[model samples]
Target: MIPSVLPTYNRADLTFVKGEGVWMTEADGRRFLDLGAGIAVNVLGHANPTLVSALTEQAQALWHVSNLYNIPQQQTLADALVAQSFADTVFFTNSGTEACELAVKMARKYWFDKGHPEKVDILGFEGSFHGRSSAGIAAAGGEKLTKGFGPLLPGFSHLTWGDIAAVNDAITDTTAAVIVEPVQGEGGIRPMEDDDLRELRHICEEAGVLLILDEVQCGVGRTGKLFAHEWAGITPDIMMVAKGIGGGFPLGAVLATQDAASGMTAGTHGSTYGGNPLACAVGNAVMNTVATPEFLSDVMRKSGLFRQKLEGLVASHPDVFEEVRGTGLMLGLKCKALNMDVVNAGYDAQVVTVPAADNVVRLLPPLNITDDEITQAVERLEQAAIQVAAQKD
Candidate 1:
C-alpha cells in the first residue's frame, strides 16, 4: 500500500514537534542536539529569533506579491547579494533545484543568443549533487541520481572529481559551462583543494566556458565564507545559491555576471512563489547576520575548534571512524563502521546526524552554536561512537 504521503524517503520514526536553537524536541518531548542543522539549511539555528521576527513581521505586513509587480524585499536582498558577490544580476527561485534549472537555461541561452547554439554542453564531475530536478540530476550525471530517469536531459557530460587533467581534456569547443560544488555535501563532504579550484576556474576561463558553482550546501558562512569559492580567490561566472541563505525559509537565487545573464532578459525565467516578501524578509535577516566579518571570523574559529575535536574523536574511536572530512561547519565523519549504524547510535545518544554517500556521517551544526554546545556536541558524538564500538565488540 502506498502511504498517504508517498513513501519516497526512508524517514526515521522520530517525530519532531518543535525546534529551538540547536535542538529539536520530539513529539514525546525528547530533545535531540541538531548537528545536521536541517541538512545545512538552518544556518543560524532552528527557530532563530532574528529569522522568526523577519518572517512574522513580513507575514503580518504582506506575504505574496508575485514578480509581476515590484517586490522591494526581493530587490533589497538581490542588491545585498550583488554587493557581496561577483554577480551583476540575480534571479530568485524557491529551491536549489530551481536555481540549477535556471543556471542550465542561462548557460544555454547565453550561447543561443550569441549565435553559437552548438555550445550547450555543461561539463560536470562525478560525486557531485546539484539537485534532483531533471537538469540537476542530468548535470550531476551519477548513476544513483539517474537510474530510471532517462532519456535524460541532454548536453551534459561527467568527469572525475578533482582531476584537473580530465577537466582539461574534456573541454571542447561545444562546452558551454563547467559546474561543480566547491564542497561536495552529498558526495561525502569532500572539499576541493584551493589550488585545484583555482585551476578549475582558470581552465573554464581559458575555454571561455561559464563556471557554475553549486554552493547550496557550503555557502552563506557554512564554510567560514559567504561562499566556498571565495576560499579559492576565484569567482564563478554563475552561482547557484540556497539552503543557508534562507535561514530555514524556502528561498533560492541564481547569480550571474553581466555576460552570463545577458540572455535572461524580461521573460527568460521566473517563479510564482520565489522571492516572496516573507522568504526575502527572512533571507535579508540571514544575510545581515551571516555576511559579516565578526560572524564569519567566529565561524572560522569554531570550525577550527570543531575540527580539532573531531580529529581527536576519530583517533579515539579508531575502529569506528576512519577520519574527519570537510571544512568549517560542514564537517563529516568517514566511518569504518557502517555510517547508518553511527547515525542510529547518535539517535540513541540524543544527537541527530545526516548520513551521506561514501560511508560518511555529516555534522552540520548551526553557525551560531555556542562554545559549550560545541563541547557538548562532541561529547554526545563520543557517546555515539562508544555505542557503535561496543556493538562491534
Candidate 2:
C-alpha cells in the first residue's frame, strides 16, 4: 500500500513512539540509542523538561502574532543571541532554508544599497549543504542538489573547499558575498581549518566582499562552541543558524552586523510564523542552557571521551572504518566500505546514525549525553563493525 507521506526519504521501518535524552522507544517497545540526535537538532536531547515547560507555558499564554506587533519573547531571544555573538541584529525564520534565503538577499542588498547594485554574485564552497531553497541550491551548486532543479537561481559561483588562492581569484567587483559552512555537515563532517577560515576572512575583507556562513547544521553549540565559526577566531558579516537553537523545534535565524544589515529596512523580509512566541520561548530555553560555560565545558569533556573511543573503534575495525573526523559531538566515521552498510548495521545493533556524503557515517550525539552513553555508543559501533565485516565476507 502506498503511504500518505511523500516518498522523499528512504525511511527505516521502525516507528519511534517516545524519547528521553539519548534513547528512543520504538513501536515494538525496543529501546534504541539515538546517536544522530535527530540530525543534530535535539541539542539538549529529546523531551527535555526545560524545553517542554517553556513550550507549554508559551502555548498557554500566546502562540503567534503578526510581526507588525512587538513580540517580547522574540525580542528576548534576539537579545540573547546578539549578546553572545558578533551580530548586532537578528532576523528570525522558520527553517535554515529561509535563513539562507535571507542571508543571500541581505548580502546582495548590502552591496546594492552601497551603490554597487551590479555586485550580486555570491561565492560558495564545494561539499557544503545550505538547505533546499533555490538560493541554497545555487549557493551549494552540487549536481545532486541542482540536478532536477534546472535553470537554478543564478549569480552564485563555487570554489573548492579550503582553496585560498581560488577564493582570492574568485573575488571580483561583481562578488557580493562568499558563503560557507564552518563545518561541512552534509559533506561528511568536513571541517574547515582554522587557518583556512582566517585566510578566507582576510581575503574577503581585502576584496570588500561579505562573508556569509551557513551554520545551520554546525551552530548553536553543536561543536562545543556557541557557533562553529568561533573556533576560527573569526566572525562572518552575515550568519545563518538553525537546528540546535530550537532544541527540536522548527526555528532558524539570520544574524548580521549593523553595517552588514544596513540594507535591510522595515518590510524588507519577514516570516509569518518565524520567531513566534512559542518558538522563541523554546529558543530561549535552549540558549539559556547551551550558552552557559558549564554546559559548554561538559560538551567538550564528553567530546574528548567520544573521540578517544571512536579512535579506538576505528583502530580495532580497520576494515570497516577508515578514519574518524569532525569536532565536538558532530563527528563522522569515514567508512572503508559502503556507508549505508555501516548505517544498516547500526540499526541492526539497535542504534541510530546518519549517513552523509563521502562515505561517512555521521555521529551527532546530544550535547548533554553522558559518558556511559558514549561508551555504549562505541560498543554499538563495534558491534555494527563486526556485522558489516561478516556481511562483506
Candidate 3:
C-alpha cells in the first residue's frame, strides 16, 4: 500500500520536531547533535536566528512579485553574487535541479547564437551528480539515474572521474562544455586535486569549450572558501549554486560570465516564483555573515580542528572507520564496517550523519558549530563507533 507520503526515500524512523543550532529535537524529545546539517543545506545551522529574522521581516513586507517586474531584493542578491563570484550575471531558481536545467540550456544556446548549433555535446564525469532533471540525469550518465528514464537527453558524454587525459580526449569540436563538482558530495566526497582542476580549466580555454562548475553542494562557505574551486584559483564560465546559499530556505541560482550568458536574452529564460523576496532576503542574510573573512577563517580553523579529531577517531576505531576524506565542514568517514551500520549506530548515540556512495558517512555540521560542539560531536561519533564495533564483534 502506498503511504500518504511517497516512499521514495529510505527514511529514518526518528522524527525531528524542532531544531536549533547544531541540534535537533526528536518527537520523543531526544536531542540529537546534527552533524549532517540537512545535507549541507543549513549552513548557519537549524533555525538560524539571522535567517529567521530575514524571512520574518520580508514575509511582513512582501513575498512573491515574480519576474514580471523588477525586484530590489533579487537585484541586491545578484549584485552580491556577482561581486563575490566570477559571474557577471545571475539567474535565480527554486532549487539546484532548476539551476542545472538552465545551465544546460544556456550552454547550448550560447553556441547556437554563435552560428554553431552543431556544437552541443557536454562532457561530464563518472560519479558526478548534476540533478534529477532530464538534462541532469543525462549529464550524470549513471545507469542508476537513467535506468527507467529512456530516450534520455542526448549530447552528453561521460569520462573517467579523475582522468585529465580523458577530459582532454573527450573535448572535441562538437563539445559545448564540461560540467563538474569541485568536491563530489553524493559521490562520497571525492575532491578533485587542485592542480587537476586548474588543468581542466586550462584545457577548456584551449579547446574554446565552456567550463561549468556544479557547486550546489560545496559552495556558500561549505569548503572553507566562498567556493571549492577557489582553492584551485580557477573560475568557471558558468556555475551552479544552492543549498547553503539560503540558509535552509529553498533557493538556487545560475551564474555565468557575460559572454556565456549573451545568448540568454530577455525571453530566453525565466521563472515565476524564482527570486521571490522571501528567499532572497534569507539569502542576503546568509551572504552577509558567510562572505566575511573572519567567518571563513574561523571555518577553516575549525575545519582543521575537526579534521585532526576525526583522524584520531579513525585511528582509535580501525575496526569501524577506515579514513577521513573531504575539506572544511564537508568531511566524510569511510567505514570499515557498513556505512549504514555506522549511521544507525549514530542514531543510538544521539548523532546525525548522512550517507553517500562508496561506503562513506558524511559529517557536514553547521559552519558555526562551536569548538565545544566539535569536541562533543567527536565524542558522540566515538560512541557510535563503539556501538558498531560491539555489534560486529
Candidate 4:
C-alpha cells in the first residue's frame, strides 16, 4: 500500500472522478455539489465546452514552443489585458507565484534602470500567501512558509495588514514596492477597506513607491469587477493575476503600465512555457467569457444570495458561526471552532469547500453556478453548521 507521500492537507473520505458545471461525481458514482470549484479556478465551471474546445483545438495545433519567438495567442491575450487595464504591457507565467516573482523583479528593475538599484525591497503583509517559490516566500514575510528554509531572502519586509502607520514607516528610500491583496484571500477573506487603499495609493504616489496588487485569488472578475482594486479607484503600477485567468488551466500574468514597465524591454524577462499556445488559447477563452457585463452581473447577484444564506446559517447557529464576509462569489464563514471541522463536514456531506486563515471557511463556488446549486450548497452548509453546534459542548 503505497501510502500518500505528500504532507497532509485536508484529507477527504471520497475521491471525485469527474466534474460538470458545479457538481462532481465521486469514484463511487455519487454526485456532490462542489462549492469550491477547485478553489475558484473554474470560473466557467467544470468541463466547460468553451475551455475544452480551446485546449483540444490548440493541442492539435501547437503545444510547446519556447519564448524565443512571437506567439500570436499570447500576444492577443496580452493585448486584451492591456486594453482593459492601466497596463500597457503584459508578461505571462506558468502560475500565480511566477507572476508575483516577475512583478517583484519588474518593480525593482524599473527603479534599477533609473540608477536606483538600492530600491529593491518588497513589502508584503503579515498574513499574505504568495506561493512556495523562494522569492514568493521571501515576499510574503511569514514564518509558516519560511520556517527553517535556511536564511530568509533579504529586502523582504513585513507590515501588519491595514496598519497605515506601520506601512508608512516601513517604506524606506530603497523600498521598491508595496504588494498586497485587495482582498486577503488566504488571510481569511479580509477585504482591504476602500479608504485605506485610497490613502495608501496617495501615500505611495507621494513617496514615489510602486504599488503591486496581488490579484491572484481576487482578480479576473471574482469581485464582480475586472480587478478588485477597481473598487478603490486606484491603479497599481504592477498587478499580478491568475487563478481564473485560464478557467481551469494553469496560467498567470503580470500587467504593468507603460512607464512602470520601462525597464522590462526585450530579454529582461522570459518564461519558456509561460505563454505556450495551449494555455494562452484557454486563457483567451476564459477572458472572453468572464469579461462580459452579464457574467459580472450574475456574480453580483449570486453574491447577494450567498450572503443571505450564510447570514441564515450565522443566525441559526449563533454559537458556531460568528459572521459572513467577502465580496462576489468569494465569501467566507468565520467559525467558532476550527474551520477544518466545517470543511471536513462539508466534504463528508458531499460539498467541497476551502479552509483559510483565522478559522474562516472559504466558499469560492464557480461564478456561473445556478441558484439551484447554491440552494443545495447552503443546505449542506447548514447541516455542517448544526453538526458543529452540537459538538460545541
Predictions in order: lDDT: 0.94, 0.94, 0.95, 0.88
Sort the predicted structures by lDDT, highest score first: 3, 1, 2, 4
Query: How many clashes does the backbone of model 1 have?
Result: 0
Error of 4 at 161 (Å): 0.8
- Candidate 1 per-residue lDDT, tens place, 56-104, comes to 9999999897999999999999999999999999998999999999999
- Kindly list the per-residue Cα lDDT of model 2 for residues 216-245, writing each as its tens digit: 999999888999999999999999999999
The global Cα lDDT (0 to 1) of model 1 is: 0.94
lDDT of 2 at 286: 99
Clashing pairs in 3: none
Q: Among all windows of ten consecutive residues in candidate 3, which has the lowest summed lDDT?
A: 164-173
Once fitted onto the true fold, the runs of candidate 2 whose alpha carbons sit more than 4 angstroms away are: none
Q: How close is candidate 2 to the true structure, as a TM-score?
A: 0.99
Please state every model's RMSD to the true fold in angstroms. 0.7, 0.8, 0.7, 1.5
Q: Report model 4's TM-score to 2 decimal places.
A: 0.97
